[model samples]
Target chain A: MASNLPVPVAESGDIDLVLRQVLQDVLGLSSERVAELDAESGLFGHLPELDSMAVAGLLTEIEDRLDILIEDDEVDGEMLETFGGLITFLSDKRSDA
Target chain B: MPMAALAGNWPNPPHADEYAVSFDSGRAVRLLIVPALFDEANKLRHFTVEVMRALDRAGIDAMLPDLPGTNESCEELAGQSLPSWHAAMEAAARHFRATHLLTMRGGAICAPTGLPCLRYAPVSGVKLLRTLLRAQVVSDREAGRDTSREQLLENGREDGLALAGYSLSPEMVRQLEDAELAAQDLPDIAQSELGGPGLWLRAEPDHDAAQTVALARIVAERLA
Candidate 1:
């Protein structure tokens, strides 16, 4: 719901911060490791930790935390390309809701 | 940590013995453990086993049953639907004369209704399927074959499709899409407060032995 919709940002801020906490918990990463990551941080192709299997688990966690339903046709490289991209997509989803 | 007592069938409903087992007989057993499905099942098995052992030690009898077509059972998964699984759990409870249930993750949605069960880390089946369906989409897209939700659902319905390495029936997918582990399904079902993070979410499936012991103790105390 747009009720809690956060304002847009130039770089990963709120969504990234929230998502990073989820990443740390869901992926079993230390807070320091997730906190070290930023908007420009590359994922999927870059992070060996984010493999196909891991991605599925991550998506499930994201949905659980964010309460967003990611559609089949909605998935693509751009959305999962970087930390910023995922945050932006999530932000948009919240706004639309 | 208690030893895994044994893996054998108990007799009451003769057909149920073909699929389930409990360590104790008659009124000694009080709980039936329905584990999470697929890979989560593999990761959660060790944790579940330890909990069962602790429960046994705490004077609460817990039974773990293999769903038809999974683990040692040779039955095909093609026809195994959610209701069938529920029926199986019900039969096992009846066979063991169990008074309560303890379920983990996906099993939360499959537990027999009206029983006083404890659900730990119950995840919505619809949310889980969305994750798997997205994986299919991404995999297909990478393969140069883009697909839509309708297209994927149709294909899944027509032919049994595998998700997260486990082959699933189309009917199972449909039922799962509708299944929820919300309060409505289990009004009186109490939620177990388990410590530690969800192991199923880790990139490499890791086990937390201490967490398992703590969880087992909590479960044992709660049922006491």
Candidate 2:
């Protein structure tokens, strides 16, 4: 079985900045939009543009932009249910990559 | 499997960038080839080819165009929408006046207008999203976090949250949250509409035969 380890936050804040940048670009939200977001902020409620089509589109965008492969079987709405959850998921995926 | 290979060897008339291929039935068929999501597209090449060959053998002409951003399609995936993709399929149908359309799994929605659709293990997009949410909840539970599947389902009703790798929007979440495959009450096409020689092939052993029968009945009804 694979070990489930919590991701480590960057002390230098560089990774955080990059992660946020990726989020902004992928979500097509302004920095101001992301500013109010927390780790738990609901992405769907907070961002109206994220429709089912957008969700699929966003997944494709993230895979392309991050150069990470997300299997269809591996994705779920909860993993992206909040900003924090999404960021955490990305962090883990990036580390693994 | 042998039949598929044999069909692949059959000579197909050459056409321009987007043209129709005809069979003895006289129905011009348009091909709407959809790529699988992300890495699965590459991994499932053999299976897709097999399916294409099967369709060809069945006398259903199809074109498996690579989706934008996946194979050779032009549009960046980020810029594409579900409606636009559907529209593209519609365009293919109109262009060909196709008699039938074939799709696999998620691509089942690719049927051209007025033509009967043949889906091999069709998966509803909304259902796919919900299943992903359920899996996440299961993952959380496996990680030692005490979580309930019901709570996870309820969470969709709360505020929309973006899953880590998935970038679900609030509206997307709501749509997925509220989506019920049963409620969609998809018409029974197999029994109603597809009586005139249609195929509904399901994977053996593990797949649900009852559901397959029900779906085939629906397709028959709709296409009959």
Candidate with top TM-score is 1
Give every prediction's interface RMSD.
2.1, 13.8
Q: In model 1, what is the error at residue B161, expressed in angstroms?
A: 2.9
Docking class of 2: incorrect
Q: Per-prediction TM-score, chain A only?
A: 0.80, 0.68
For residues B70-169, write the lDDT of model 1, one tens digit per residue: 8766567776888877888787777667788888888888888777787877777776676676666666676788776567767777786786566789
Listed in order, the DockQ scores are 0.52, 0.02
True contacts kept of 2: 0.00
Show model 1 residue runs off by greater than 4 Å. Answer: A1-12, A95-97, B1-4, B10-29, B182-192
Lowest summed lDDT over 10 consecutive residues: which window, candidate 2 chain B? B196-205
TM-score of chain B of 2: 0.49
Error of 1 at B6 (Å): 1.4
lDDT per residue as tens, model 2, B21-79:
22223334434444344323443445455444544554444555544334544444444
Candidate 2 regions with alpha-carbon error over 4 angstroms: A1-97, B1-45, B57-60, B69-78, B95-97, B109-112, B136-224
Residue A61, candidate 1: C-alpha displacement in angstroms: 2.3
